[model samples]
Target: MLGAFVDGELPASARETLEARLADDPRAAARVAAWRAQKAALRALCEGARVSGEDAAPDAGQAGAEPAVLILRPSGSWWWRAGMAAAWVAVGAGLAVAATMLVPRLAPGLAPELMAGAAPTAARSETSEAFARRADIAYAVYSPEQRHPVEVGAADEAHLVAWLSRRLGKPLSVPSLAEYGYTLVGGRLLPGNTGPAAQFMYENDAGERLTLYVASSAVDRDPVRLLRDGNRRTFYWSTERTGYALSGPQTEPKLREIALDVCGALGGKPGQW
Candidate 1:
């Protein structure tokens, strides 16, 4: 269990089970810590070797300079060659460790716990919190785009809503935030875990933008909640047929007010602030 945890190969439920046991067993916790430390050391060694090799490489501008070369002379004894072979094997092992650590970072949309060398906690299917986190990540990824931020603009709001409604299998509406100094900028269609989702964007005169992410859900009752990730605050809720998340870089109190307005416009009850 400790090895799998360090390698980030454990399933979420099994990892949670191991973590619970570790909390009660100090010795197991210590072992896990040692494993993490060893992995870190191996990664550092591999990085140092790479940096050193890069530093030793000839610069492109030094074209007139002689290129450096390394030549290996075999010793007379068989044991000497065997020892060198073993050293190369050790170096290969170190490189493998570094590559393992880099794989998660290079992969798209990897869980934070996996990249951090920790096990992820299990989540229920179509949970509101999980949906909110996904919405937040999508907002963070797309909100900064200077071009092509949305698939459809507010100039075509009627068509955009109709298209998304057909894809999501639910009636969709765009909330008006004109009272809050925000005008509809545009909207976009996004792929959700269970089905298609829609994102409606609004921008104020100051250029600050906010987004409403809506998708179909099976929950019959409202599961309204507020979540904060980095500088963004999201208020999420679910109805019998749809889930909604409003995310922006605004104060919680202000975002909550906007969330209420959005809920009211959508004809859903907003959670008490």
Candidate 2:
């Protein structure tokens, strides 16, 4: 139940009930916090699949080390099973296999560059940086696709927004980019650091593409900033704990203009971000 709540998979009514309970019982809230941290650490290990030498996995042949090789038991779903297998295959006997033991030592003991990127209470700066990087990666991976770039097409805009809104636990508005020569191609659901994220893709007649990545966050309103990652450029900001990043191959000035437009179209106040 706590995991479901943290994931925003619980119904709103049940979530309210849980929140009330958590408010009355500090232990419940603590449990939720710890669960979210564990989820984040696991996600990091799976994505990075590497451990710093000092925090490396316990030796397999060392005495008393066998017990530390924790295997993730999947919860009887095809997706879970596949994820488990992928993590195992990716890390072998490395980070993914040892994240359970590795996470506890993360907070003040390791560098921020490690697999455990940040603590649960890390500043909005960290979150915004990660959000932009993820957006850059997402654009590089999916924007080049000639087929199936998005799970839902623009024709079903209502359904796409509704579906992504449910997953992110926040209502979303799909901004029109037609004025800028880019039309909404579609959008897709994505995995976020803490929960779920959504990405909306747009394309121009010249086949150039841009993507907007959005996710629920816990951040103060941050002004838009540009991040250049290789050939991709991203303009990212956060308002009321919701992070947004617009990424593409366009010129910095052009992309910045479009990002500001998206921020405005989504009802973000000019001073808010």
Candidate 3:
């Protein structure tokens, strides 16, 4: 009966069979919990990590040494009898495997590299730097000469905040940059596999432009970092509480200075921005 449960083939008959066996044996319950936890750990590891089916099974002699070793070997009479019931259990286990997977795909944490990448890129990495760069490029191509800054304009600041906040899963505010000699032209909503995204445009007196790309963190498991790539300098860093990526074209020192001011205004320490 315990073997049937471990094989994930426990059907009504198996349950009836196991009920009698388990009723007299306390170890059966412990085994079931252990197997469940084992399934859970396997599912969690699979969230973003790739694996081959061959490596999915637990080693035989290692069984019960750790609950994670109780690999569900779905076969034989057990699965045949239970069918989809076992499938539903597997799905429930999968959901428990990772709450981050349940977040809206557009809401951030889309790519693992930004989170797992080396150092600062990893630290300040939100969902995807590629997406951030793509977003910046898209804005650069489309927003100049008032070609079209946004689907929504500054007049709709309320809608802008709510819509972007919903997509990013983080509170967002368009920092008033008028003090920095820039005025908000407007903002645009963008597509992201991890979640909805937003870009706020600010232009100075000389027509110099800067866009703030905001999104949710892909992982909160690490520190913040600053990344410089191509023609852009990004002050990417994360707080123990959250993550942020600020990228622009200025020199590293200038970008760093701006990042410091922005971080200060955003209630984060300047050293991190």
| Overall lDDT per candidate, in order of appearance | 0.80, 0.82, 0.62
Best by lDDT: 2
lDDT at residue 20 of model 3 (Cα atoms): 78
lDDT of 3 by residue, 165-235 (tens): 87777778777777768787777777653556677777788877767766555544333345655776666
lDDT of 3 at 43: 54
lDDT of 2 at 202: 96
* Clashing pairs in model 1, backbone N/Cα/C closer than 3 A: none
Residue 12's C-alpha lDDT in candidate 2? 83
- Name the best candidate (by TM-score): 1
- Model 1 scores a C-alpha lDDT of 0.80
Off by over 4 Å in 2: 1-126, 271-273
Q: What is the lDDT of residue 71 in candidate 3?
A: 39
Give the lDDT of residue 236 in candidate 1. 89
TM-score of 2: 0.55
State the displacement of the C-alpha of residue 26, model 3, in Å, after optimal TM-score superposition: 75
How many backbone clashes are present in model 1?
0
